[model samples]
Target: MKITREVVQGLYKQTGTARVDTDVAASFQVGDTIQARNINPTGHTRLPRYIRGKKGSIATDNGVFKFADSLAHGAGTQPQHLYSVRFTAQEIWGGEAPAQDSLYIDLWDDYLEPA
Candidate 1:
């Protein structure tokens, strides 16, 4: 299917900021340890390849938002808690990486699990 200007405009009109104002349970919290679930999906995904399987700490709550993968597949919004997770550079790039360096990534509840 070819995408044109009209479809793009319609989508922007339908979905505003993509932030859903609704109450949803947060599976993890700030300072809590979490591991990014490692799954190579054959479809749309928000998780980055480098972040997968890496352990991190929840740095902030980004609140409930529509799930991107689901929405990309024509599924309705699946609002869920989003978090800013902090991972040590060393954890992702091995011991050679500086310990002081850290990377923060915004991840969804479904992409994380207790570490």
Candidate 2:
């Protein structure tokens, strides 16, 4: 996905106008199911290399989705979108993760929960 100048410009405006704070965390709760797409279904993605083939429930309820940034996609674009998903570390990485810890990745609408 490529982020157009218009989208970047809008982000700039939002940041400049204080509509959105840079310190904000898109995922702030549990059970928040989000929609995401495999950045590189063939290769690797920052979406936690562990969460490639497994599935989990939304443990948080974060607010509106936002961009995941193409920095992980190897495009370095600012493709912005809406995403709200929360998964257990075990769900993504399996038994190797701590039982008390989980990973909440802000994804795009393209990645999602069970319908």
- Using lDDT, give the best candidate's number: 1
lDDT of candidate 1 over 27-55, digit per residue (tens): 99889999999989888999999999999
lDDT of 2 at 7: 80
Tens-digit lDDT track of model 2 for 1-115: 6899988888766453212233444332344344343444545344655554445555544443333434455764333333345567776667988988866554543454342
Q: Please, what is the whole-model Cα lDDT of each candidate in the order they appear?
A: 0.93, 0.48
Query: RMSD, model 1, all Cα superposed?
Result: 3.5
Clashing residue pair totals per candidate (backbone < 3 A): 0, 16
Q: Each model's TM-score? A: 0.86, 0.41
Superposition-based RMSD of candidate 2 using all C-alpha atoms, in angstroms: 9.9
RMSD of each: 3.5, 9.9
At residue 84, candidate 1 shows an lDDT of 93
